[model samples]
Target: MQPVVHIGAGAPGARIRWGPSPRAFGSGLALFALLAVGCSEPVPPTVTEPKPPGLESEPRWLTFKCVKPGCDETLDVTIRQVGARKLAIKRVVLSEPDRTEYSIESELSAPAIVNEQFKVSVRYRPIGGPVKGDVKLLVTYTDASPEEGEGRIPPGEVSVPLLRRLVGEPVLVASPARLVFGAVSPGESRSLPLTVSNAGSGNSSLVISAVDSDEPTIGAQALPALGLAPGSSTEVQMGYAPQAAAYSEARLLVRSAGDMVAPVEVLAVGTSLPDPTVAALPAEGLDFGRVEKGTQKRASIEVVNRGGAPLELESVRVVGNANLAATLPNEATSLTLAPLESVEVMVWLSSETSGDIDAYVELTTNDPSARLFSVPVVGMVTAPHAVAPGSIDFGKVPKGWVLTRPITVQNEGWGELEVKGLTLVLGSSDLFTLRSLPSLPLSLERHQKLGLEVEFRAEAMGPFQATLSVETNDPGGRFLEVPIRATGSTCAEGCPLENAVPSCVGNECSIASCESGWFDTDGEPENGCECSEIGNDPGSSCQEAHYLGEFPDDGTSQTFRGILPWKNDVDTVTFFAKDAFNWGADRYDVRISLASADPSIRLCVYWHETGNHLSECYLENENCPESRSFQRTGTGGGDDADYVVKIYREPGAAPTCKPYTLSVSNG
Candidate 1:
């Protein structure tokens, strides 16, 4: 059997025995009892803190590099420890994926102890590593005592996300390297489109920090936020405004966030053209020459644009004479014109009063040089009056025939006038009477017409004469005279022929005029007789024939001699008539002694077609003895008839022939 023995714990090489002698047992018991009383509990084991491997007592900054192509990202880190030590550290390790993708530039390993600042540098093999996952450091430390108990520091892990610096800043690429606005006009603006794109790879996000222009005339603006995605584009509008006419330039600066050391510069260039010029076609003025009163005239002026830019007309107006007016394109408002465009303006000149007419038309425009322009208009006005035919006559008519003639009086002045008294003056007042006499003091305005009528009655077989006197407020005269003459005779037997010699018929004296107003000094009938010293008087036949072309339709009159002193003394005249219609009483009228000085004269109408006497009349006979003038009217056989007027003294008791004037006329 083995015996056990106990000694003091502090004793070195203490032993326990099984079969020891009684003497040894007795001695061990005594020692054990003494040692037991003096011994105490044993002390616990010491603990130590854990730190990063090979990184303890160093600055905590850790650096990492992004190894991606075109990527220059870096990461820095600091390691630290906290809390009371309670567990033992096993090792310090990096997360699995992070450890494979990133490499630490500094020396750091597991199971390391760190009590102060240290530095650790890490590099990312791929650009995506820093942005994707977190690389963590695991710190494992123990606080355990062999003699006391198992006590250790708690396990700790720190995760740090690597920051991504992305690629080379916001790599902005402009579609066009320069901005250009071609030719521009002054007071105008031009714009062009600018495209900015981000051209970067990996996890790079681009941002446009700013866009600027150095020139005041140039401006730039971007739509939405300046930030853009990889391969994304943003548009910018660039504007240019030129103040003067010349070439211009500017610099457009663009800046982006991140690693760019300098901003992008774009050149802007433009040119400004001159403004438009306005001018009129007539360098002098528009003239509306010679316009009468109460008349209107027109003139035109052309407005032209002669510059590189548009010209605008603001307004147009007339500045002179109240009678003047103007019309222009868009007269009430404004008119816009393109380069080299033109328009015409119309001007009117009028005169309400009698005088020279003048006016000016002014135009307002947007031309730089000739802003305001004018044109002139000129004209003249004249006065007015009117005069009618000199006389009215009712031609020869048979006894008891009545004839009427109309006389038209026109007012030729600009104002109204009055016609006063009208009366008949004759050797026999009852011979001529007014039929449709206008009222005395009759009113007539400018361009107005009035008519007066006078009638002649051939009640006797003799020549008669009378005159119509009219009084009016005319500038020429207050009194006007119209002669009336005619010869009246019976339709049967024609007129009585005078017989100067008892042996010869008085008709023999109607032969050639050597027998008229001529005496043979030798008293020889065989030789040609010599003319008397007395010439034909004014009242006697010697005057040119009066035109009775339209007869009564065109009223006319003629005065001639109605006297025959010697035997067979005669006066002859001619006339043409368009128709065989009656003028007032007849188509043809023959009046002898229109002055009422002699009523014994005879009037004969001889037709050229027959070469014979058509009619003969002596208006003063029988009940017409008081009548002085003779009137006889008759119609021809056909249209366009020609007639001859033979006026002479009628053979009677009185041997001496009285010189007298006669008239042939139409109503």
Candidate 2:
């Protein structure tokens, strides 16, 4: 046991057992207590933040390699934190800007790497220079810890320089690779030439193939099978003949051996030898005998190919009847048939009938023209047959024209109806023609219709009556006779008229007047007074003779000779009652003119009362002052002398320029 030592209490600072000095032993005990405190005290351990593994602080080793395009390469990079801990960095920048360029995908990498493993990798893209791309990598590593040595980690960089090369692009171009020949007909042969040209800087091969128009027997020829040199060309020739009208469009497929195969079109045309001709075939058509009601009968037609080449089939298109069908029965090229080969075509008849049936078979083949041969198919239907709206009615058609009547022939019958001949009869001359319309060979199917347009033109307006006859395969309506009435015309010009003007030259008179100066209406005779015979100027209301620029007949169709006896100086006057410019014709009419281009002269006459006030027998004179206004007085439109005008060559005493009070009448 140890004793406490304190000076103030019982001991100075230490105490020990009595006897020999225990100071040394006491001090040793105190030392032992201190050591125990130091060893046994619970102290919390501190966790210090680890210092990130730092990159080797040294000059960076950067290498450049120029590849394609062979541009000189250099680098430029500024080391900002060569000595600083946080921003410490070493770089190599491109010095020659023309040879190298640097681009970072993000702005955060502009200054420094995000971590030690982050780096920018560069490679040559060969686009006229050394191209640079960026690469950022993340790696795991560790530094020396207090208790543990450094562990192995992936060696990487935030961004690292990587010298790489991009492949160089080659020059390429497209060339024609395929050839096609359009459509070719039968009996006609044509040839097409194919030329191949190399448009690329490099050479290429062409392997052509036919696509659509493949005629096995026909052969083709092409030049230069190996290929075409750069900027060179080759040609191919294809020939074939079509027995019929056909278009041969062949597709040519070409392969360039290495690059590509292009397709092109080659079109060809072929002509045919007219379709099969059956000159000796039955013209009466096929005869299907004893067809019971409600049963179908089929007839087959045998045709022989008489042309030079094999029979090339165009088509076996059926016309008319839905119940009746016609077919060649096989699906093969028509040319497979040799010359003089006979083929059978079947015509099916499925309409209701009790007697014989007729079916027309049309055969078209390698010939340019094909003839139509008919085979009669018999069929009987148990149900009844009828026709709706089958009659054609022509309403009031004018004469001298062809009347066209279009009618819809509806099949209201359970059995198909066969219509044979439809005709317009009763005085059907060359002027009247009956068109049977588009011929529908077989049945009038239920709800089926046939269009028939019939024309009747030769109509004359006098109650024309005639009958239209129609014949069909229907027993009841085999001969349909219907009445067709029309009105005919007798007069070509208009209707007849009464009191037409009759001309008479023996007395030189027409109708109510006589040329001997006598009028039937008036009884008396005069020198020149068949009043109505002379025409007056309509423009001028004056009663005067007119000489048109050309001659005009006053009473007859014949032209009257020029006004003789009156010389150029004499005035043969024509009066225009209306003003030419203003064209104003007053009811009183005032303007007057001379038909003759001469001066005005009045051949006057005297009048005095003898029997009545003016006697025709007593007033006979060749000259006098009695005259009417003859010439225009001024621009005001009246003659200077209101009634009298002196003769043109008066010489001695002139006739007075005054209006005489004597009256004159027509010529």
Candidate 3:
């Protein structure tokens, strides 16, 4: 008998009865008979249902619509796994009829496992009109291996419907596919009319959406989004503005609401003229080679017009170095140049002196691109010469004292200028002498300068005037006379350092002897002697300000130096002009600079008569490393004018003295 057990009972413990058997009867009955025996129920065999094919897709249909312009139509289909079995997507393709307009955008050549998802992109083109088909996916999968019968499943085709709408099929036609605007000036414009018509169904709405030109210079536009019924038409005007001289080609893109058909393209052409272009034959410059002094040379420049329109020549003149002259034909004063027309203008060079002839042939024309043209003309006028200053002044000299001054003599002509001799022609020859005359036959090249020195020894106190002549190879003349004037003085007994008194010096504008080892270098007596030595008290108040006197000449600038003595100390330098009316409304620039390790020094300028502050500058603290500069560029005054520059230190600055410079320059 088989063993009996409580089966199918959901309980932890149960009673079981065992039937006597041959093997059980023979077991050590004596020792095992006393053990307790129990019986339990057995569990039945579990059965599982087979999984169906696993391929699935979300939204199993794909639809494409070609409505928007300049863009393709596409849709996505998702293939997902649904069951507890492995599957593979082998290949995906579109139906035969849809292959012309649709194609799969994803590759499915490799095997895909279970629970995997795939997104397939379907692209559709509207060129093949409206179409409908199915997206067929070929899938290869496996059956359950653990359960009975497991093998490679057969490949099956899963179809998903694909719908496409070639949104609108409006027949858009643009008449005369090309346009030409014959010729237009740079600033002129021309316009032409274009017609767009739709010969489709009345239910369709056609938008004359866009009209664009390839060239920005060519302007075009159409009635946008023009709603038209079948057999209807509208006109668009296109304009062209030629900004430069060129043959411009452009294209017009006429688009409809949909990419229903290819865009109607219109070819456009325009021409803008640079009427006349002046081309010089040499293309660079005209050289009259070598010309002789007091003679003439001739050359010509051909003016050619390589353009589509007439070039009008207004005038031709000579500019630059005046040694050369340019002459145009009488007919060229005012002439027109037809397309590819050319003319020749005669240019002449005549020189009265010896030098290089550098001039330009300036031609004026009506061409838009080029209005004025300059052709260089160069030639060498052979001669040799020297130039001397008009006059020289020894100023004032002391009695029985010898003095000397020098003037520059420049070679103003080409080649070598031969110096023959220098002689005293007039005045007291006994008092004047040539320190060292130029060596005989001294050759001076072009642009070379030499200094000629003259000496004067005064034997008595009186006024003296003399003329010294310079002999050179210049053809203009053989002798160039330079005048010299001076006065001699002797220091009187008890001579004091006063403007009217005798402050004896070797020569005027030289350092003069003053009491206390003081010397005057600027020839100004209004300051009681202005000195450049350190620690000299030039006065620091408006009343005791140093008088700088008048500027020596128009557009002359003077620079002077002074010192700041103590904190809160203001140093004043006053300037006066003798002929302020000569400058008219012209402005002057007055700059004052103060240099110091301490940055708190300030410079201020004011009108002496009015005491009005003009400008001031100063550094804030010691951290700043720059110095302060005060400037005034505009001032008005009477004939006898007075202006003052003041230098002061800020309140918190150190009391140490510092040196500063004041400069007055032309504005």
Candidate 4:
């Protein structure tokens, strides 16, 4: 057996000695040796130092390529545990002195072993211009001890700072950001230049995929895939072609390849020319109708510009008739009308000859289609002819009774008739006298008639005859002679009633007829039909109104005669409405005029159904008559509407028996 040598624990250079044989020492020696080794100051353990925790990132600096403002770019930073110990990441932080443009998206959660890799995602969004920031990783070494259960022991964390710079910027810019093409006519095309450039701070080139327009009418010139170096620009044409006149706009979008930068927007604007047109009001033409000869009639012709552009009127003239003339409203020969504007041309027709007139007002304007437009001027002039009955007979009039007969002379021709003279023929009966003769040299228009009344008084029973002469300016009938005749009869009793004619019935005097505005109210013959219109006033209220019968809707004026005996007397008269064929009883206008020789008569009108006063009391005078007019619409059904007119004397006026005439007409 080989003997074993044991070295005793010593400070330095300890001696080695041979121990007894294994047979002789046995287990005791072995135990002693083990105790010797255990009892001696335990050799200081050969301690092995643990490797320090270390982190190494792939990219030391982060660089982000942002296309434009408010654009984000992400970059992944791979962190690896290079040391022998495990490492834990406590936190990740993004820091910047100015604006915060960087953020950590994802980070490692568990502790990393040796050679283990983890990633921290960082996102960068540039506000504007050049921007930079830092990313810090807080990490510490993890403990090597085992955990109580299946989990690892919580490591005492000590954060280690890691920083990286982030840079983000824009690369493309547009020059002359807006393009305007002004006043492009319809079916016309116009274009303006737009510039696109690369504005990157670095040496990178900018690639534009396309330049497009949003509007169909507005477009940009086609460009191949273009690449612009930094600080270099390229020009493209922005075009506008309008099919019709209108305002249009569009955006010229410049898109970069790969969306490295935001799409550059260039606003484009344009306008199209407007068209001008001329039109005439009353497109048919003007007609003077039947105008009186030797007189002038005036009318108007309106020239309008119906389009969106200004219209130029060259000249307005009248032709085809020497007497027809046309003048602009301002007497100017030429004028300009704005869009949707109009100008009136005054036209006058005068002639001494009597005939149908055919003329035209010619208008010259800048309207391409209607350069020469004509408005017809048509009218007729005629001479007046006197028309009268050859003779008028009064039949038989009672003795001591007076009566008047009408001698009507009308102008049946189409011109003014001047009555030069009206006289009784020489050597005519003295019993016949002309009464209510229209003043000499009276004028009458076409279809107008004048009444020359001949009054006959029966002083004694006889036959009266006279010849009335009427001279006028009628070319055919210059002078007209109308015979007036009346027979007077003897009555047993003379008619003594004022304003009453006597009728002898079996040798008794009775009332035959009373004068206008007078009535025979009392039956007694002694009074002799003595009741004037004032004696039986119509009424003072609508309920007691006296119906004056329905008036026609032909616009013919009718006169009603009445006498006011005293002051404070009111006469209410009602008339049923006639259908004007305008929505039932809706009358266009109802006019009532009051006139009297005494100038003290006043008039008032009211709508009877509603009892609403239409007109306050108005006093009449020689120059200006009192009148009231109203339009009754939606009032009644057809002829069922009734209107009341009240007549009275002016306040504080003296009582008199003067008669008044109320003229009423509706259209």
Where does model 3 exceed 4 Å of error?
1-277, 287-293, 304-344, 352-400, 408-450, 458-467, 483-667
Clashes (candidate 2): 102
Q: Report the C-alpha lDDT of model 1 over 1-667, residue by residue, as the tens digit.
A: 4465554422223476668766786677677666766474433333556543322211222334343434444454555444443233345456665345555543445444454433455555553213333454434444332345444433444434344445544366775887767667878998998888767654455666667888888877555363565666778888888887765668888777655535678887765746776667686777666555677777788876655577888888888678777787556567877755668887776667655556777888887767787777665553334445577655545455566777777767644456676678646458777777766778776678777777777777677777777677664577777777766655433222222111113422111324455544333222335334245422234243332333332346665543454555556555554434554444445343344355655555544433322333222122222344544444543433345555555675232434555555553
* TM-score of candidate 1 to 2 decimals: 0.21
Top lDDT: which candidate number?
Answer: 4
Worst 10 residues of 4 by lDDT: 616-625
lDDT of 3 by residue, 1-667 (tens): 6675553322223356787664665464533444523333443434667655666555556655554333477788777766555666655665574365566765445454545777777776644222223444333444423354455454454566665433345678887687777567787889888888766642344667788888987756447443654456778888888888775668998877667656889987766755555667788889876666878777889986656677788898889766666656764457887755568888877676667767888889877777998888887887776788888886656566576888777888776778887778855467887775666777787888777778888677778888888888887788888988777765442223443334445333323445452434344442334443464556676566676666522566777776554445667666754334444464444444555554666665554432322233221212211446554444454323356666677777665434566676543
Tens-digit lDDT track for model 2 on 1-667? 4453332221112334444246776677667677777578643444667644444311132334554343545433222221123332233233333443333232234334434333333333334322233321222222222243335232322223333333332222323333333333565555666565545442222333333345442435544444443344556566666544432334434334444444444433232333433321344555555444656777776655544356655556455445566767574323345544556766676754433333455555545454343344433343424454434444443345355555555555545566665666757533345565775455665567666655566445545444556566654567656555444333222211122222333422234333432222222121122322222212111233232221111111112122122122222322112222224421222222222232333343222212112111232223343333322212433211112212232333332222112121111
TM-score of 4: 0.29
Ranking of all predicted structures according to lDDT, beginning with the best and ending with the worst: 4, 3, 1, 2
The all-Cα superposition gives candidate 2 an RMSD in Å to the true structure of 39.5
Give TM-scores for every candidate, taking all chains together and pairing residue i with residue i: 0.21, 0.18, 0.31, 0.29
Q: Which pairs of residues collide in model 3?
A: 6-41, 7-41, 16-39
lDDT of each: 0.56, 0.39, 0.63, 0.67
Query: Candidate 4: deviation at residue 464, Å?
Result: 2.7
